[model samples]
Target chain A: MITRTLFAGFGGQGVLLMGYVLSHGAMHKGLNVTYFPAYGAEMRGGTANCTVTLSEEKIASPVASNPDILVAMNFPSLLKFEPTVVKQGLVVLNSSLIEESPSRTDIDLLQVPTVELAREVGSERAGNMGHGGSSQGQGKVLRTQP
Target chain B: MPSEKMLMRGSNVVGEAAVRAGCRYYFGYPITPQNELPEYLSARMLDVGGTFIQGESEVASINMVLGASAAGGRVMTSSSSPGISLKQEGISYMAGMELPAVIINMMRGGPGLGNISASAADYYQATRGGGHGDYRTPVLAPAGCQELAELTFVAFDMADKYRSPVMLLGDGLMGQVMEPVIFPDFIDLKDLPKKDWILNGCEGREPRAIFSMLLGQGELYHHNLDLQKKYDQITAEEQRWETKNTDDADIIVVAYGTAARIAESAMNDLRAEGLAIGLFRPITLWPFPSTAFRELAQNGRKVAVFELCLGQMVEDVVLSVGERAEIYFYGVPGGVIPTPAEVADFLRSVAKGDGEVGRRIDV
Candidate 1:
């Protein structure tokens, strides 16, 4: 029962923190987890992305071939990773920034207005965290966390 | 040193493990993926009352390691592929001078500044003694964070025990991955064994001069002979490997570091379908774990060596297995990470009643 996820956005969007939150939360709950920060592959304006894999058993590969979930905090991130999400997988996109819908219809899509939500909450930079919670509900992965 | 279970980044785990292992001096230059190691040490070293220096360059950093180790300090330095390439001369010097220091190479892309992705392309450079010398650096290739933590301690111990340079080898994936790990109790520095060969604290005895230069006739040859004897002893006793179900298996997969992780995943996927396959992982890349590896090939099992480089370690695998079994090779070069599905595809092909496995197949 391995749940592999990729969280992506520009450098300062706290995208990596989103992955860390999920990874740490899963690990704290006694699940095996591996969070891989990929610093080189960002083609759109040199952003950093990370891949997080959490499993009930030991995880073999930290580099996910096809992610079960992709939390895209920006337009380019969505554009870049939307094609790589596995079929019938989940994609939590920030509707605040990614205006276009996903091209593939096989996977599940959940859109949240994270930018406006972060602005409303008075912390404009916390937009990534707003949508990051959407994927935490996946596989009941973070249900036990406070 | 807390004994509680903790989730930490792979790089940070190494830093804390080094500190817990009684390492008091660290010198390293920043490189992509491995930067977190020095970053963690920068703050943690201060807390541990240790010394951390962001060396001006990779060469400068390894030389600093050489100096500190000569002074009998538990010291370490880390770098990525290109950075490690630059440190070879100093590493060679350390080897010839018989200094104990731990060096971590969080391997990234290739020949030149390829990319910041995981790769085991430095296998030949590491296992064959990257620097020019009649010396072999003990190499520990950790597959995950837990092993990463444990092996850091082993690397330090091996370095000091052998009075030679030691390398902790892993790819960028090992560096960036954050995983849960419970480490052992911290090693009290005072309990560590004393070294009389160091260049410092010789007030009551003759002032010690430590160097690799043996200009006298037969001096370098005798030094090389003694170093060879030490390496031979290491080869006999320090070959470390792990085998999964090789006792009753027809096919064995050989790999190390990050590549072994992928190979295990692929092997497991095949095992679910009930394939008679096993995995042979070498923890000690140098010393190469040849004896244990040779034992696994006794029953005419088909051996496959998988690596992230273009068939470097496969040569060592061939030498280990020899004509005892049918040996095959699978390689992924240039920092491209191979998925388990792809690796499984290859393994599946080999396992499906094939009359003979191909020799040196590079994919």
Candidate 2:
């Protein structure tokens, strides 16, 4: 089985770190994994993202135009990648930051109050983990949090 | 005895390996994805009685390395894509003077004004002699943190042995990735072969001038020819590669550095699918392991070259095969890297003789 996920948000939102953690977990599970980040100016306050592919076999291109899971931590991320989610794919959005939800009928959209869940966890930066776990519950997306 | 293992970034691994190899001087400017190298060296060099300088610019850094090497000390400098471009002139001069120094390039995207993204776009410039003049620098490509450490030591050894500049070519991902690295046992610098050509004030000996300039055309031509001879010797002796499951394989995938690591994963996937696919990873980018590739191609196997840049190393692969076998290219440009699955897919098609041409995957 092959699972690909893209996490996108503002630079300091820990989107890249989320991807790193996910990739590391996948590798630890004995899956072949590749993680690539949007570097350069895109990392400086702009929309930053990372693409990770975890597979039982081998992963081909690390670039995923249509990801199996799209974790959007901000409004721009949701708007930019919402259209590229695979059919029946899961889209996890941070409800606190994204006022409008993706209305794509082909994909399952989960609107999670990620910031609130993170605050409940005693760490505001755990928003990505909150969204990641919530989306994993919806299906197909692997449980990435260790 | 086994070496000690340490959790290190690929860049710092290179720096540490250089120190272990008896490098006494380091000069570099800070660059993203590789800044940790000079930063780590700043402290480590002090322990070894070496010197580390954060230069004003990349040009100054390379020149400083050249000066230190000229003074009979093993020296090194490092930079990323744009910074490397600025140091090309000094590199050419170093090569001309036959100075022994190691230069590390944590490559990023580029033609002009490219950013801090991992890309092998500098392949042509690095392997084909980016610096001017009829000269060449031995380029070593390391796929992972382990190779990053080992190859750094090799780079220093090769520089001193050949009395020429050596380049350690890595990318942004390689620079930043954390891995367990085994540090080599310390070798006594005094035990290494002496460098008589270095200018050490020439006290009581005939004055030795170290310069690339030759006034006469014949002398210049002779110098270039001598350099070519050395390159030819290196090509014959120093080509390094790793071959996985090539025997009875139908498709041989050629890749180097980080791309080779992805290819290894992809090769495993193709093998599980009952397809005959093997991986050929070049550890020495310049010498290129052409002999092994030529032998593989002559065995009537199809070749597929994968790279992060458009058809750079593929051209060399084709030349190595010498039209004895059909070759294909799969490239991902603009700071993109193909996943192992994608590479497996390409390999499967090639093995089946599906005849699918090159394609790009946007992430």
Candidate 3:
């Protein structure tokens, strides 16, 4: 089975780093993988995103139009990519930053108040990590939120 | 010998591969999407006892490569779209002189300051002898990080074998993607064929001149005829391509570089659905693997040429297949890359065209 994920957020939100880490782990695991990041001015305080695809077979085309998982770190990213997720796929969002609920009804929505949770844990900038960890754990996004 | 696996970007791996291929000199200017190539070689070439120079411009850089090649030094240069345009004059001169050099074009969106995004728009420029005059250069397109490294070694060899420039054609995506690659043992330059024609201070013999300009009557014409003969030989011997389940298929899709990778996935998807689809990826863009296309056409196969540009390689496919096979084309120009699912769906829609005539040709 192939797993495609789209990680989107503002430029400074560690969006591309998350993709790199995921692809690095996939490569070490001997899985065929591809990580494509948006380049140029978009990486400087603008909307940025990356596509990461891991599969047992050789991956074709690094651009995923409908990813199985969507990691939206900001409201813009969520609004921009919400409609493109696969049916019954997972949408992991930082609830603290985005107040508008996703309009899609077919997919599973996981809301983590990552900023609020990061602040409570005293790091304040760990929202990206928090959301990433939540995206990996499919069923615990809501169950583990204390 | 076991090689050490290292994780690196495609651009850096290509640079390292050039060094391992016995490339002792590099000249290039900085350009986005491919800046890492020159940057990596700039610091590492000296470590390998090679020379690296960041030229003021692409023209100057390609000329430096020409000079290095004329001296019989294994040399390379790299640039992006606009930079490659600037190097065309130098490339024509190098071809005229019959010098050996490796040029890497990590193409970005083009047609004048286009954008810093991945694109295969330079297909025509790379394969059709972008430089002026009548000359042809062998070109290779690598699909992944490992292929990028592997083709760098092959590019150097092909250049030296033919006494002409060879191009390693890729896009920004191939340059930026990071993956694990294992480096093999460096080729021993001493063991390879020596450059007997190098003008290394011709002593104890008659004086030899290396000239790109021949103004005498029939001088350039005869030189061009010899070059044409050499090109014909290369076309016969150096055509490289890959086929997946093409032995028995109704629809054969022809693509190259990243587009080929995507087309492969699409073919797999369609195959699972009982569609008779196969993929043909050209590793050597020039020489074009036309023989493979001719064989497929002789076996009565239909073709669909998919590209990231506006149908460049499709022309070659049509010429090779001729009226014996029907041809179709789908292309997304500039930096927009079509998804595998999208391509698969498109292939599915046309999978049942058993008796349809050629869409691209009037016959």
Candidate with better DockQ, 1 vs 3: 1
TM-score of candidate 2 to 2 decimals: 0.82
**Model 2: per-residue Cα lDDT at residue A143:** 58
**How many clashes does each candidate structure show, in the order listed?**
0, 13, 0
- Model 2 chain A worst lDDT run, 10 consecutive residues: A137-146
* DockQ of candidate 2, scored on C-alphas against the true complex (2 decimals): 0.17
Task: Provide TM-scores for the models.
Answer: 0.93, 0.82, 0.93
**Candidate 1, residue B56: how far the Cα is off, in Å:** 2.3
Q: Write the per-residue lDDT of candidate 1 for residues B83-172, one digit (tens) a residue.
A: 999999999999999999999999998889988889888988998888897888899999999999999999999999999899999889
Q: After superposition, how far is residue B242 of candidate 3 from its true place, in Å?
A: 0.3
- After superposing candidate 2 on the true structure, give the runs of residues whose Cα lies further than 4 Å from its correct spot: A1-7, A18-36, A42-44, A51-72, A75-95, A98-112, A121-146, B1-7, B31-33, B43-49, B186-193, B204-206, B216-218, B341-345, B348-355, B359-363
Model 1, residue B273: distance off in Å is 2.8
What lDDT score belongs to each candidate, Candidate 1 first?
A: 0.87, 0.82, 0.85
DockQ of each: 0.62, 0.17, 0.54
User: Candidate 3 - CAPRI tier?
Assistant: medium
Writing each residue's lDDT as its tens digit, candidate 2 over B1-363 gives 336555556788888888888888999999887888999999999999989999999999999988998888889999998988998999999999999899999988777766677889888888888989888889999987777988988999899999999999999888876555678877798876698887888789999889989998599989999999999999999999988888878888899887887787777767887888888889998988889878887677788889988879887886687668878778888776666767777777676666564642211
